[model samples]
Target: MEWIILALVAGVIGYGIVIYNGLVALRNRVRNAFSQIDVQLQRRYDLIPNLVETAKGYMAHERETLEAVIAARNRAHSAAQRAAGTSGADAGALGAGAVGELASAEAALGGMLTRFFALAEAYPDLKANQNMAQLQEELASTENRIAFARQAYNDAVMTYNTRREQFPDSIVANSFNFTAAELWQLENAEARQAPRVSFGNR
Candidate 1:
């Protein structure tokens, strides 16, 4: 009877250890995923100015849209800095905040880019410019990468959240300060309402 009781106790302790370790691993994965998203976003930021300059020469009348995109980019850069500092604490909130920053900036940039293209339709010379075409293609590709990175970040958060919310793992997570990761959501609710009509007439 003594030996049987001791074996049962040992099994429970071992199982608990496994659960704790798994939770830790999942938490780390979430952090790493966020870092990857940041790296890609930074790459996109560096590309923005080059894009702005490329678009500028062709469309002098697009001053307002171009300015908005630049302003949004600045705000996104600031928010990213804040997110970096407070990582692992209310990570969901921070991730969401960062997403807000990047999304807002990207939206402004996208809007301006659309107008830039539409305006380009009127100017055959601008359309035929090698630099403009190349920049446009690169910008499109970078946007795709940003989207993919966001998906990866969400996937990591989902795995971490699943473990954190599970029965035995929740106990471990609570004791160790590991918590559920938040999904990055759009900050602008109004933008969700429509197909996003351009500021200027089509």
Candidate 2:
């Protein structure tokens, strides 16, 4: 009976190790997914200044709209940087807050971009400008990439969260302090709507 007890204990210990390692791998995947999103977001931030510069000459009258986009972009970029710097168990609460802030800032930026594009409808010269057209196309591509990355990151987070919350794995995850990752989400309903712009007529 002593040998039987020893084998049962060894089996439980081995299973715990496996669960712990699986959680660690999932956590790493979540981190990698977040990094991908960070890269896309950085690309978007870099493109914004160029977009605004190209709009300046033709959008002189819409200065407020342009300024709002720049301000929101700056806020979002800063929040993203802060969130990227966070890690480990302490990162759980801090990262969640930072992610929430980033989402709000991004939503604000999206709204400003939408308004700016709407105003651009009246500026035929702006629509006809080759530089503006190119910038618009690049920004659209970056937006699509960001969307894809965000979805992937969220999916990873969902998997990690589920594992951490599962029965037997929960015991191992909690013991190892494997906190849940926050999912990326768009904060604004209006931002979900594609910007209403029609440059074809121009």
Candidate lDDT (C-alpha), each = 0.67, 0.81
- lDDT by residue for model 2 over 110-186, one digit each (tens)? 88888888788888888999888887887888788888888898898899999889999999888877877887777
Top lDDT prediction, candidate number? 2
Which stretches of model 1 miss by more than 4 angstroms? 1-10, 88-109, 186-202
Lowest-scoring 10 consecutive residues by lDDT in candidate 1? 193-202
Tens digits of lDDT, candidate 1, 1-202: 9999999999988988999888777777777877887786687677767767766887788787777667766776666666665566643324445555555655555555455555657756666777766766666666677667778888888888888888988887787767566676644654332222122222
| Residue-pair clash count for candidate 1 | 0
What is the C-alpha RMSD, rounded to one decimal, of candidate 1?
4.7
Which residue pairs does candidate 2 place in steric collision? none
RMSD of 2: 2.0
Candidate 1's TM-score: 0.76
Residue 144 CA displacement from its true place in model 1, Å: 1.7
Q: How close to the true structure is residue 33 of candidate 2, measured as C-alpha lDDT?
A: 86
